[model samples]
Target: MSRRTLVAGIGNVFLGDDGFGVETVRRLSAPGAAAARLPDGVETADIGVRGVHLAYQLLDGYDTLVLVDATARGGAPGTLYLIEAGADGPVAPQTPVLDGHQMSPDAVLALLDTLCAGTGAAPPRRIWVVGCEPGSLDEGIGLSPPVAAAVDEAVRMVLDLVHHQDEETPQDEPGVAAN
Candidate 1:
């Protein structure tokens, strides 16, 4: 497959704002979604709470991988952060805990590192985390008000990355993609 970019969304929908990634990707994949017009080779998936599954999917080669998730960084809820991580990964400092049931981006990256070692599948050249500050990770079905509102912006951010990455370094405010 000529998958150039993979925008994977992973999170626990049962936990309120923690579902941001899942929701954002849902919007991005909608039939008429703004990001739907992306050129061929960009792929998106809603990998809800499946850390191990994401690790295995890396077997397919992609030059860039953009992960969308809810990050609790002690910032205000709904805040957006675009962090570009090295090949070793963004959460390399912390020890990754491998759990099929639960895995943070850190854990996922660590698992991928190990997989690449044994399988010889090269990891993506660039990795990015488009994260949103979560309000409540508490057990719940719906997102908090603030988090729900930020979904649109998060979608735009992902669109920006896949659209402009090859053209130039992504800007803080990415330009609108031409039709």
Candidate 2:
């Protein structure tokens, strides 16, 4: 398979559940890292609180991209959402914070779109986001109970998507998927 899958966790570790993304990455990076079971081609990285930095990461050769973050939209805490990258969607503005570190996921997508347009190349074939609802984004450094519990589930969902994608695409030979 191709090493063209990038899973990024985005969040601020200083805030409570807002740190969900970073924490999830940590959990998956531990010795028994649960996310390690994901399909062999995909690579995961923690992009904690980096705004435009995500765009740079996207510059790497990746056919698919998945971003995990904590979203607050008045939903029940710990709710998980599978969001596609686009303009017309239910995901709200990325204005949750006022600091310079704040950057919209859409903006990153736009940057990729512009780059692809300029170069006459296709953008990431797949871009998905797993958003976890946060009960509190107050000044703190950990995830609440519910959000923490959903970490494993989120990892599983992403891996499942990766596997399904692999099965859908025809490989050159058996056990050989795009890399």
Please list the C-alpha lDDT of all candidates, in the order they appear. 0.81, 0.69
TM-score for candidate 1: 0.88
Task: List TM-scores for all candidates, in order.
Answer: 0.88, 0.78
How much RMSD separates candidate 1 from the native structure?
4.1
Stretches > 4 Å off in candidate 2: 1-3, 87-100, 118-121, 166-179
Clashes of each: 0, 3
lDDT string, candidate 2, 43-109, tens digits: 7788886766776667766888878888765677887776656536433444542233776676566
Candidate 1: lDDT of 21?
93
How far residue 105's Cα lies from its native spot in candidate 2, in Å, is 1.4
Number of the top-ranking candidate, with TM-score as the measure:
1
Candidate 1's residue-wise lDDT over 38-71, tens digit each?
6678888999988888888977878888898888
Candidate 2 lDDT at 149 equals 80
